[model samples]
Target: MAKGELVQAIRLLTAERDLPMDRIIEAVQEALATTYKRQYGPTPDVRVELDTDSGEFRVYAEKLVVIETQDESHQISLKDAQQYPGEPGLNEMVEVEVTPPNFGRIAAQTAKQTILQRIQEAERDLVYDEYANREGEILNGIIERVEPRGIIVNLGKAEAVLPLQEQVPRERYRITQRLKVYLVKVDRGVRMPQLVVSRAHRGLVRRLLEVEVPEVFNGTVELKAIAREPGSRTKVAVAARQEGIDPVGACVGQHGVRIQNIVNELNGEKIDVVPWDDHTDKFVANALRPAQVIAVLVHDAERRAEVIVPDGQLSLAIGKEGQNARLAAKLTGWKVDIKKESDAGGETQEAPVPPEPVAVAPGLPLDPADEPATMAELLERVPNEGRDEA
Candidate 1:
């Protein structure tokens, strides 16, 4: 870059990165001086300056103008100091310009290296600043590469590492494909800061809803809690500030367009938008959506609950492999145990029935009955009028 180009680049960097201009200028000058000292001998009192307007860099040496020099390397005669237009006191330092001879190949290479290193450092800083405050927010980036452990996404200012654990299982990522991710962390562990991205975090679901639902972005609808099984299902509870506005309906949008969009982004992951309530019973009931809850018995002291569902609705409330009940517990911050009304009602204690002797047919061998027979068999053998006596 030309002298003017260098100055312009520095100015742009300072503005874009929100860095102090003096600090950036000092960084550039220090790098340049380091380059110079590495190639040349221990040059004393070396100073570098870049003209703010012209971008011209000047190298000079400052020396003390002394009547009797104690250190010849750093002190100059009063007459020489006067030549530099400085009123030299008894022991005053005067800056004098130094022009070295034949700084052809070495100077060019040093300057190139200095500029490149400074630019990289500044760029790293800019990237760090841009992403530091983005935790829990959504960002879109291009897929740079897919590694064995994760996918690298190139945000406009920086590249973020999206680890496999943070990604939805079975989601396909193609190079150069643009995708949105949740900013989970900004770690400054290495030379450059790392932007850790996630697709499975609950924040991702919230962010996607915020983008698609205007009411949420406008602060009219608030997301209370979210529970998600990445690539499988998610449940979000929301509340509306204004009366008569259904928070769940608002999030669902027209014909489920809003939720469908988010599902598509998550590779067809299912989502349930439920209304939030301060009452624990109502909240837990909502969390287990698409299932009819007969009653919710909450033990507030222990944060535990017993949810009763109709006998026919038992499987629906418990879900496949108990995922529905599990997510309900997470979303409502309670331990949920679901039971059907018949199961709960029929759990009364009764006297154990005596095992019947295996009947052999005329001395032939007999097969053992599995455990105990059904209650109907025990009641059937009893005479209708003699059951109470038995």
Candidate 2:
């Protein structure tokens, strides 16, 4: 490139790429030095300087001045060094200009490639710094491609990967689909900064709430805990930071608009916004929502609670597959043993009929009854047994 054009390009790069001019100049100097070494063999003392104003570059070879020259490349006689601008003395170093007559032509051939490579590196660093501090925030992105390893999302300034483990099991992604994702982390990669994002992280829900609820964003509502079964249901326990403000109501918004927006974003994932209570019993009861609890018996030493629900609410309390009770336990940090009120004599008791333990794997349905007996049969037998005992 012409000297004028080179100077203009540097200015354009500084303005367009948001890169400092000095960095580009340094890159050019390094590239030119490399070009010089390529043509004339390796020389450790060779240096290149580029004038910022004129975009003119020159190569200099630094050599030590000696009483008599022995090593031609490294040492120069005081008589020979005296010809340079700076007055030379024995044992002093002098920089001699060694710009080859056709050096500019050769540098031009490779300078563009090297400068572009350096600019790419600088851009990667800029992207990494921009996202390194956003580990917990949310970003809107479009699905770029669905690779076998993960989903690639175009996050405007950078691309992010939603690994298989981080995606919701039930959510399907398509090309060009738009969604909000949680920034899980930033990792240094071979070509660029690797942004790891997530759709199933609980933080996604937390951030979505902050976006939708004014109270949550301003700290008028504090989220105490969250228990989530991605693609299925999530329970959020919230408490008011200020008195007379309803935390649950604020998160739910007017007519449930706030929570609904979050649900829609999550592809219809169910979210339960429950009030947080300092009292363990009340907290546990609130955690198991849509299921009325007759009473709760706390065993503080064991960190367990024996919950008594009406006979009709057993299936509801246990959820379709023990999801309700499991999430309630997770939310309250307690082991919950749910039982029918009839089994507890219709009153709070220290101990109730310990139900038969059934081994159920995660994500599997819970029968709440022994094999060969359907839930209806177990329900019928229970009432009959109660009547017979009476």
Candidate 3:
């Protein structure tokens, strides 16, 4: 390339990547020096300079300015230093200008390769630095392709890998599909910079909730915790700041519109909105949703709970395949064991079991299977069990 062309190229690169023009010149000069060493012998000390304005390059070889020199190869007399005013002082080296006639071909190729490599390395470092602090943040991407291990998402400047282990179960992926994912990890390896992305991470769910719920973002509502079986069900505990605001109602939106958006984003994943509480009993009771919790007996030392529900609500409390109970345990951070009134006490008779309210009444039978039993009935049926304030 012509000198003008090289200068223009450098200028374009400097502006494109926001790199300094002087740095580019230095990199090119170093590349040229290396090329020179490869072609000629290493005996000569070489340096190269470029004119920032003219885009003209000059190569220089340093030879010691010595008097009565034994070695003619690199020594220059004081007379020579005087003539070359820019030369080094007393026993110091002077830069002797040497313009290679036929070395431009090789230097040009080497310079191009060196500049490209430098830019790539710099770009990688930039990307790594920008995303290092963003670990666990939500990022939007398009599905570029699917490999056996996971899906490759094109996140503008970088390609993030959404691993199978990080994917929600039973979720389908398609090419060019727009999706939002959580950046689970940022790794710097020998080959390339990596951002391990995830669609199923609990953080993803949290982010989705934050996006959908303005109250969460504003700190009016706080998400205490989240327990998820991705692509199937998720239970989130939310709390409100103001006295009049209902945490559950706020999260659920009007007629469940808000949470539905988040669920839809997770491929129709079911979400159970529960209120957060400082009290373990209230929190656990809320976590086991749709199941009328007659009482929450907390054994704090063991970090476990004996959740008492009426007979009809036991199945609901346990959930299908124990999903409800499992999520409840995860949400509450407690080991929950469920029991019914009948299991606690009462004789088995051949007579038909009465309604829940009647069977669990004081001095009456404790039929655990009775549906929809009230708190009054449960206290009556507990026999000598203490009603401690949880």
Candidate 4:
């Protein structure tokens, strides 16, 4: 390449690739050596070096002095060595410049491929470093492409993999759609950082609360625990660190706008914000919101509670397929046995029954065994079994 053009290209590469000048220079020097080796026979002990300041590449051959020439490229006669730099002795090594003619074209091709590969590798390392320290953070991204195993989300500077297990079951993806993803893990053991991000993680809700609620971000209110069924419902237990904060009200916001935003983000999923209490009975009662709990009998030894509600509130407290009780149990870290006030005769009991199929309508899921119900009430009966957060 021409001197001016080479210098300009180097400078441009250094700026555009965000790489140091020394790295580019080193790569170019290696490329020149490789090209020279490929073009010329391997008989000579070829060595390539660069003048960093002048950007000059010089190839040399170290040939041993021999009395009689065997291989022309590897051995030099004593007379020839003596003619070159320094007085040479028998069996001594000397450096001889061996730059070949018409080799710049080969060097150009080798250098182009080498420099581009190095640039791409450097970009991967940069992206890895940037995200490795950002584990457990919530990031905004756009759906870049759909893959067979998962979706690739572009997080501005990098792309993250959203695996099938981490996706909401019923949610669909459109190209270029923006989304909020929770960064659950970062694997730096590989050449590229592997980010395991999730949209279904319970931590997503916690992070969204931190973003939407100033009280949570400022630490006035702390989220004690969260039990969630992705794409369905979430039960969050929050408490105020100090007095006068009103943790539940603060999280719910004025007329429920703050919580509504989170609900909207989850595609209209339900969220129940409950106050956290040090008292197990009170905490358990509050955790089962929109359900009236008459009493909660805590068994410290078994780490369980027998919750008794009024007869009419039995189905409400147990929820559809016992989802409400299950989530409450998970949030409190206790096994819950919800029972009617009349069933409180026993202290220790198992999980609640299915309420004798409710008697409102028969043969259909969530329908009582008796009369017809409206669609609104039918939709409200959806619940998942209490499950541990993954």
Candidate 5:
């Protein structure tokens, strides 16, 4: 290629690969040096220089100046060295132009390969750095192809693996389909950056909330905890860092638009956004939404909480297959024993956990504290072994 074309090509590569010009130039020079050594014989030290702006390529044979040559390729007589640049003295090196007549073809081929390889390496690093900072963030991509182990998602600049274990059981993928995923891991690979992404991770819900809700993104609301059963249900505890902001309201958005968007993204997975409390009792109660917790008897040492709901709320709080109670326990990071006023007698019954709410009372609030009372008064409300909470 001509000098001007070579310079233009380097400029284009910088723009396309987003690599620095110096790196590309260095790769080209190194390739030219290698090519010169291979074709002209390897005994002499070869130096290649390319004017980044002018694209003027030059090759030099560097030989040590000596009174008498011991090795013809590496050493030159002092008398002969005086003819080269720097008018070298003994023990000093002198550079002489050794441009081969047919070198353009050989050097062009070698340098092109080297420059392309350099660009590829730089692109990999660029991709790795880009996603490293984005760990735990959500990204949208298209399904490129599926392998036996998992699906390959084309995430614009790179492709990521969504292993079978990380996929939602109820969700199916197809070619060219658009999908949203959470970047759960970034690992180094031999040739490229290894990215492990997921749709089933609990962090996916938190990331989606940050994306859809401005309040959550701006730090007005904080996601204190999240528990998820992929393609089934997710329970999130949100609290306002600053007073006067309704944490639940902020996450749910106007008319529940914000949460609904997140739900839609998760393929209709139900999400329950509730308030969080530092008080264990209150936090447990908040976690068990759609179920009224009359009071929570906690064993701090055991990290177990006995949640008592009114007889009427037992079924609702336990949820179908006890999903509500299960999620509550997960969200609170504690073992929860759900009892209705009737279950207080210490008998446990299996509740059918359905995907949807069954006979849930919409008006029932988590707290029934309209009437404040002392601990003794509250204990009086406990059922006689027969009372349990839902």
Candidate 6:
């Protein structure tokens, strides 16, 4: 390549890859240095310098000035070194120009492959730095491809992987389909930055709310807790941060437009926006929404609540397969034992001894066949159970 062409090529790369010119120049110098070492012999003292404006390059090799040279490549006799620009003394190191006569041709031959490799590496690092600080932020992406392990999404500047475990169970992905994803993490991969994104994460719900609800985004309302069964349902507890603002109303928007947008984004998942309370009893009652709660008796010692609902509301409170009661427990960070009002009677009932701690691992869903007969039994079977505030 001509002297001016090298500068133009670097300028083109800077614009095309969005990389700093200095970085590309550094990469080119390293590539040329490696080429020099490979073609001649491996040595640690070889350095390549390129003039950024003129785009001319030269190779220099450092040699020790010795009274008598034992190695021709690594040492120069004091008499021979003195013939160069600077007078040399014994045991001093000096650099001498060692540019090969045909180096430009050689550089042209090998520079493209080496330069591309270095550029790709620099691009990966730039992308990793950009996304590392955005771990919890939501990004819009298009489905690029589907593999057995997960779906690949194109997020404009980079491709992100939505692993199977992080994908919503009921959602299907197709090529070119656009959706929003939560950035889970940025992993250092062998070839590029591995962007791990998620569609099923509870954070997705939180971020979507921030986008659709002005009050939540501006901190007039705070999200107290969220309990979600991906692709099934989610319960959000919100509290008013500023007086005169209805947290739930602000989130729901006028005629439910804000919440509905979030629902549509999640592919029609059901969401319950309830008011949060500092009192555990009131919060628990609110969490089990659409079910008329007659009373909530709290046992502070065990973080348990005995909820009593009207007889007609029992089924609604328990919900299909005990989902409502389960989500209520998760949201309030309590062991909720829901019962019919008739069952509670007009007497104080001692909190039943929690059955022997169930050995199930926390967060793992119980098998359908092993599901308990009642909400009380189910809550008792899960250990170390609590809300996921993150």
Candidate 5 backbone overlaps, count: 21
Error of 2 at 149 (Å): 1.8
Ranking by lDDT: 6, 2, 5, 4, 3, 1
lDDT of 4 by residue, 237-354 (tens): 8889988888888888877788888888888778888877788888788877678777777889999887888889999998998888888887888888888877677642534322
Per-residue CA lDDT of model 1 for 255-316, tens digit only, reads: 77888888889888888877777777777777777787777777889989888777998999
Question: What's model 6's overall lDDT?
Answer: 0.78
| Candidate 4 positional error at 374, Å | 48
User: lDDT score of model 3?
Assistant: 0.72
Once fitted onto the true fold, the runs of candidate 5 whose alpha carbons sit more than 4 angstroms away are 1-22, 35-45, 50-57, 99-105, 112-116, 345-390
Model 2 over residues 86-164: C-alpha lDDT tens digits? 6888898898888888877776656678678888888888899899888779999999998875899999889998877
Backbone clashes counted, model 3? 1
Q: List the residue pairs that clash in candidate 3.
A: 342-368
Per residue, candidate 3 scores C-alpha lDDT tens digits across 1-390 of: 876787788789878987667766787898888777777767388887777676566778888888767765577777777788765577988888766787666666777898888777666776788787887689999999988756999998788887666676688889999999888667764456777777766677778878888888788988787777777777777778877877777777776788878877888888877777788777778888767777777889999987777788899889999988988887787899988756845422222222211000000011113211332332233311211101
Give candidate 1 misplaced runs (Cα > 4 Å): 1-28, 35-45, 50-57, 103-105, 189-192, 346-390
Instruction: Give the clashing residue pairs of candidate 6, or none.
Output: none
Candidate number with greatest TM-score: 6
- Which is the winner by lDDT between candidate 2 and candidate 4? 2
Error of 3 at 27 (Å): 3.3
Q: Which tens-of-lDDT digit does each residue in 25-134 have in candidate 5?
A: 88889878987887778946788888767766788887788999988778889999888767899999887777877776676677778878888887888889889789
Task: Give the winner by TM-score: 2 or 3.
Answer: 2
- What lDDT score goes with residue 164 in model 3? 64
